[model samples]
Target: MADKPTVTIIGLGSMGQALASAYLEAGHRTTVWNRTPAKADDLVARGATRAATVSDAVWASDLVVLCVLDYAAVDELLAPNADVLKDRVVVNLTNGRPDQARRTGEWATAQGAEYLDGGIMAIPSMIGTPEAFILYSGSRTAFERYEAALRVLAEPKFVGTDAGLAALNDLALLSGMYGTLAGARHATALVGPERAAEFTTSLLIPWLQAMANILAPSSAEREAGDREAGDLPSEESPLDMQAAGLANIIEASRSAGVGVDLLTHLLTPMRDIIAAGEGDVLTDLVEVIGKEIRS
Candidate 1:
């Protein structure tokens, strides 16, 4: 391998462009390809090579990076070029699920490609900066080999050898993000459209940020609610407040004619758990979720 590796990038969207820039800045020889050639102009202007086709890009580099829309797009773009994929390290920074990652990894293995699934935890602006964190899973050697070039996207966190780990954690963090937005939507709707943005910027934003710190404490308390988990009994069980308050909030939203169906749906499973007499189980809410708590 040369002192600075050569990199080929597919998917020239905002995130892809950012990655390309980062790699170019780090002095890697960058070969870029986009579904539409126009998008590669800026990178080309910056001394990068623009490939006419996906196979050309893949064949030109030791590492082929993908930062496309999703796994579906990935499958569409690369599936036709399976013959060209042999003996290459394919790093997918596309968003997907654990199952998708594992399935895709298997497919890549069939093509004689070493697959590395990655989840980008940062927005486009943070790419290559210290603020971004990227999760990688698959071959440890692949992670180590491309660590320097990959650091352009974020701090590379090798999430173990499981190809599914990257996509799984990606889904996990997205759940929290969606939940936070869901709560924001609920709060903003409860307050009026005119006041919603103001409330989010002022009240709701800080409140949710506060939840970050208090959440760990309440998390423990929630776990204790599960008698099977042997939680210490407390006079003030949080379930009463949760069930009743959420019920009331939904009721209020209904009374005001605001659409709160989503929040109601999210809490429904939790409500069902509590009704099933798991009210004391703090972590019982995890059952409604798609993954276990990060803890």
Candidate 2:
């Protein structure tokens, strides 16, 4: 019924521009900035004001939306102008680490500013959709203060006040995505690209999505340990099949003159599963996979 809010968005890359577009569409006065300057031209054409510099961008609004490369970039760019950012609610939608988040949160607080570390769960095109799972962690007060501006990007998923949970969760989800990708790469090679697309689009996508949904809850399930005490869904995928599948890729790559190092590295350890005779259970091969690579 009225003007939504005045927001400043820095780093006008694909994701950052998408954020600017969403805010503009939602009736917020959005001031945008980018290193190249030309990157913000399109956003400028969309009724968004392009700030002269990062300092001006920060000075333009009560909320600063940072959707940049990573947390390191945030520090490198904002450190000099930290004084201008004092007391502004900074909603960092950049990909980063939990430790980095805590460090950044402390730095922002020291400068008399508020910070919220956010993890984006959607692609650039899905910016304003409800399925875009946006994660925010940090000061609850800061998050509440700028919740509306955050919503201009995605379906805001508030992870808690821990200041690191969002990054941790973000990393976990990314690991799963990469894992699924690894499997697909191998499968495409095994089945041949011609047939790969058909199998992948029709079967792989749905199958992996279902597994991912199941695995989301199963992560907690395995932690609680009431579901018969074991590893991942071994009975379904099977360790022997998976092991053979991995081996087949390694062999095929050699024959096809392609590098299969990643495959070997990922699947080589599973030889123990086959040796242990639990090759029928896909879950048993994962006694060594740790939290470090899940995302």
Error of 1 at 226 (Å): 13
Give the TM-score (vs. native) of candidate 1: 0.85
Clashes of 2: 4
The root-mean-square deviation over C-alpha atoms between each candidate and the true structure, in angstroms, is 4.6, 4.0
Model 2 steric clash pairs: 174-295, 175-295, 234-282, 240-279
Off by over 4 Å in 2: 1-3, 213-225, 228-249, 252-259, 273-281, 291-295
Among residues 3 or more apart in sequence or in different chains, the pairs in candidate 1 whose N, CA or C atoms overlap within 3 Å are: 128-152, 222-282, 222-283, 223-282, 224-231, 225-280, 225-281, 226-281
TM-score attained by model 2: 0.84
lDDT (tens digit, per residue) of candidate 1 on 1-295: 3587799999999899999998888888999999999999999999999999998999999999999998899999889999998989999999988999999999998999999999999889988777889999998888898787787668999988999998888888888888888778878878999998788898888988776654444555566653333333334556546667778888899998888777676576677666777654444455555322321
Distance from true location, Cα of 155 in model 1, Å: 1.1
Report, for all candidates in order, the number of backbone clashes. Answer: 8, 4
